[model samples]
Target: MINQVSILGNLATAPRQEVLPSGTVKVSFLLAYNSYYTDRSGQQQEKAEFFWVETFGRSAVNAGKFLVQGQQVAVAGQLSGGNIRLENGSYRNCTAIRAEQIEYLSKPQSRTADPDVEPAVANVEF
Candidate 1:
């Protein structure tokens, strides 16, 4: 079964990055998705949801460098289902996703974006 998801949201906080023992990079961020509409009273109403998103490998590393709190971004990934093991010998089945491609929705600050990043997306298979 395919478990892909695409979302466009604003980063609630800075992307936290770390390097694993195996040399793979990890990046995490909080994204807030919102919806708006006119209510019965003719007032605009907005609803929002916050999600904790993460990525692995080079993409994860780039996310940490290019993304910041409040920046808008778009991402596509596969949802993951796993369990969180507690110190009390309990487990909590949790939900998350691994990103495949992430794009910043905001305009570039200058002619040069993040120099560390490739100008275009790479065609590498995971």
Candidate 2:
């Protein structure tokens, strides 16, 4: 069965990086998307949904470098299902995306480069 999904959304949090005991890198983050729908009354409404995204290897490394909280990104990957056990002794079904590819759509407007940091581009034309 094909288990692929693609989504374009805003990052809900900063990408967290971790190094496993075996020396592999893992990066994880949440992506939030807004869905618009019309009710029977014909009024438009918006609803927000969040997804967990995980990436490894070069994809993880690059995601950590270029992605930040609130940035717009497009992710393509497969959905994997698991379970989360709460402290209350209840198990919650969980689903997450194992991202194979990521694309940066836009950056946060409030982000600015520091004077000490070099510009990403030496020259550019609009």
Candidate 3:
């Protein structure tokens, strides 16, 4: 079965990076998607949904370096589910998108105004 999934959303939190015991790089972030609908009373309603996204290897490194909170991005990947251990020592089931491709929909806010510095790449896929 095809497990492809794609989403365009804003980053809710800055990407977090970690190195696994096996020495692989991992990055994760929360994405927020907004939707609008017409209510029965003819009023417009807006709703937002959040998703957890994860990337590995080269993509993970790029995401950690270039992505920032509130930045718009498009992600293409597959849904993955696993259990995560909580601080209380209990494990909870979680679902996340395993990103294979990420495209920056909007330019990241520059941290410096130096004209000599290079800009972040707009699209990354691995």
Q: Highest TM-score among the candidates is held by which one?
A: 2
TM-score, per-candidate, Cα-based: 0.66, 0.77, 0.74
Writing each residue's lDDT as its tens digit, candidate 3 over 1-126 gives: 999999998886678899989998999877778799999999999987666799999999999999987789999999988554455667666567999999988955566756565432312121
TM-score of 3: 0.74
Checking candidate 2 for backbone clashes, the offending pairs are none
Q: 100 in model 3: Cα distance from truth in Å?
A: 0.5
- For residue 21, what is the lDDT in candidate 2? 92
Which TM-score value belongs to model 2? 0.77
Estimate, for each residue in 19-118, the C-alpha lDDT of model 2 and write its tens digit. Answer: 7798878998777888999999999999877677889988998998889877889999999875534456676565678999999988866536554542
Q: Name the weakest run of 10 consecutive residues (lDDT summed) in model 3.
A: 117-126
Ranking by lDDT: 3, 2, 1
lDDT of 1 at 43: 100
Q: What is the per-residue lDDT of model 1 for residues 19-49, given as tens digits with 9 covering 90 to 100? A: 8899999997666778899999999999875
Clashes of each: 0, 0, 0
Off by over 4 Å in 2: 82-94, 111-126
lDDT of 2: 0.77
